[model samples]
Target chain A: MRRFAALVRRDLRLSLRAGTDATTAVMFFVVTVALFPLAIGPESTVLARIAAGVIWVAALLASLLSLERLFANDYEDGGLDLLALSPLPLEAAALAKVAAHWLVTGVPLILAAPVLALLLDMPAGGFAVLMASLALGTPSLSLIGAAGAALTLGARRGGVLLSLLVLPLFVPVLIFGAGAIDAALHGVAARPHLLLLGGFLAAALPLAPIAAAAAIRQALS
Target chain B: MALPDRMAYLTVAMHRFANPARFQRIATAILPWSAGLTVLLLAAGLYLGLVASPADYQQGDTVRIMYIHVPSAWMALFIYANMALASAVGFVWRHPLADLFCRAVAPVGAGFTAVCLITGSLWGEPMWGTWWVWDARLTSVLILFFLYLGYIALVNAFDDPVRGLKAGAILVLVGVVNLPIIKFSVDWWNTLHQPASVSRLGRPALDPAMLTPLMVMAAAFMAYFVTLALLRTRAELLNRRIQVLQMARGAS
Candidate 1:
């Protein structure tokens, strides 16, 4: 457990020191969300109606933008080979990385979403639901993105391939996350949608790391 | 023979065909049969589906689109399941041909999925009064189509073919979780798409006239997949041989 925490701290420190990945991702999220009003026209009704979908889709793409660095950096510098030889299991190491990624990327995106939601004039009732949905949903995105990053570790055009590999998997999260806000907008209880997101997170939490670990091992081999 | 001996014998039998040389011999022998079956079934199916079957009471000739759409949809799911199973076998057992089979199946599966989507859209325009709907079934199938494209793209992205194969295999396994969701999305979500008419309790609700042609067309598509897979796997094996020979010549 201590080792896991240390690994997480190390990754967090590394990402913070580099100071580009998380910031770029959040900026991309904001810029992507900002573009919707321009593209769809500056009408409040139009923006409010599609705000959840626009925010969720932009966040999904933003999360994907930084995923290439998730394992490629370690794989390139021989750090991954050493990590595979470490006392900590590779699966736990993967989980630590995913946790750190979510901390830097997912949390910031979640924080920024409500602020951007205002640009779209989202209803006041949707703020809590959107935040809750992102809170529950973004971890799965990081977890699944880790597997995608691991799988594409040594591939050519990895950024493009990663999007292809990960985006379809992102559909369920997008559906439930955006669905929750849609339900709130229509005065329906968003509980079911939120719970479904939670369920996806629960299932993805343990399973994704194992898959990622296997892919990392394959890449190192 | 005892259980362990029997298992050993079975493994040997399986491994015999795992060799590329041996697989080529067998594939050549069966290719003609599969090709013949494919042509025969397709001819018979087209005849039955396009000519023999009567038009739907409500849909008129447009119902014939279901003949192509349904079978292509079935093949899309079938090929994905097969690909996933092959990946699992390759990952656990390291079967030499499993990865080859996976690479061979992906594009053909994608083609079938594309056909399914295009025909489905054509059918939907006349019936549903739109080119597309965000209903559960259509959305899930669209996702399946993307999964096929992803698998194909991943499998070819690495300069090291072996690494690409292994990576693609891992992805195949990860994507298997979506299969069940796609299968059941209609039941779980209240959507515009109709629920399962073929695989429900007891007998299928489809009329006999429609059902017969559908079955024939499905058989044709299955035969087509088998024929193409064998041919493609053979080509892949030959390509690998050429790569090995080129490396050997370069070293010399």
Candidate 2:
């Protein structure tokens, strides 16, 4: 457990010092959200109706930005070999890396969501659920994206391939995340959507790491 | 025989049969039969479906699309399940044939899925009054099409053939596990689709006349899959051999 925490902290420190993980994803989120108004016209009603969906999609794409590099830096430099040889199991190592990723990129995206939501004229009622659903959903995105990153470590066209591999898997999260906020905006209970989002996170937490670890091992081999 | 000798013999036998030589020979024998069955069943199914089967009272002749659409959808799901199961087998045993089967059958599965989607759209335009709807079943099947494309791309993306096979196997297993979750969540998110009306577990509510051709078409699709899979696996085996030869020549 100590080793796992250390891995997470180490990743967090490195990414923070580099200022890449958090900034890139957050900036992409902002740019993507900012495009909608220009593209769809500044009609507040149009933005209001699509606000939840647009925010969720941009967050999804933003989380995808830093994914391919998740394992690339370490794998290329022999760090992954040491991790595989460590006393800490590689699955736990994978989970720790994904946790750090969620903290840096995913949390920032969640934090920036409400600002974008407001810019799009989303109702105040949706603010809480937007953040709540992102909190639950974004970890799953990072975890699944990490698995795609590991799978594509040395593959050709890694970036495009990673998106294809990861985006389809992101469907449920997008559905429920947007659904939860849409529910709140319309005065419906968001409980069921939140619960489903939680369920997705719960499933992704254990399963994705194992998959990522397996892919990592295969890449290393 | 001594224990060690027997074990050695067993291993050799296992490998011999596991190798594609034996498989090729077997496939060679069965291909004609499978091809014949495919052709026969398809002709029979088309005749019965397009001619013998009565037009639906509500949908009229347009309902005949189900004869093609339903079976293609069934094959799409069926092929994915087979790939998933084979992927697990390959992952556990490192079975070369299982890996080959998954790779060989991917395009076939993807083709079936695409057909399913296209026919569904064609049917939807007539029945649902639109070429598309965000309906749950439609969405899940569309996702299945994407999954197929992803698998095929991943299989070829790696520089190393072995790594490509292994990674593809892992991905298909992951996808199969998520298939149910995606389906359920999509269903939960919104449901404006019809319930399963026919060809269900207890008794299909379908007309007896329609059932015959649908079953025949399904059998025909299965046979078509077997024939194509065998032929493709043979090609893959040959491709691997050619790669080995080219590398060996390079080394020389």
- Report, for every candidate in turn, its global Cα lDDT versus the true structure: 0.93, 0.90
Pick the lDDT winner: 1
Model 1, runs deviating above 4 Å: B1-13
The two-chain DockQ for each candidate, comma-separated, is 0.91, 0.81
User: What's the CA RMSD for each of the models?
Assistant: 1.7, 3.1
TM-score of chain B of 1: 0.95
**lDDT tens digits, residue span B27-98, model 2:** 999999999999999999999999999999999999899999989988888889999988987786677988
TM-score of chain B of 2: 0.90
Minimum summed lDDT over a 10-residue window in model 1 chain B is located at B10-19
- Under CAPRI classification, how is model 2 graded? high
Q: Kindly list the interface RMSD, in angstroms, of each predicted candidate in the order they appear.
A: 0.5, 0.6
lDDT of 1 by residue, A22-89 (tens): 89999999999898898889989999999999999999999988889999998989999988999999
Model 1 C-alpha lDDT per residue in residues B1-252, reported as the tens digit of each score: 999899888778777878888888989999999899989988998999999999999999999999999999999999999999889878877886989899998999999999999999999999999999988889888999898899889989999898998999999999998889878988998888788888866799999899998999999999999999999999888888898899899999
TM-scores, all models, native as reference = 0.97, 0.95
Q: Candidate 2's error at A32, in angstroms?
A: 0.9
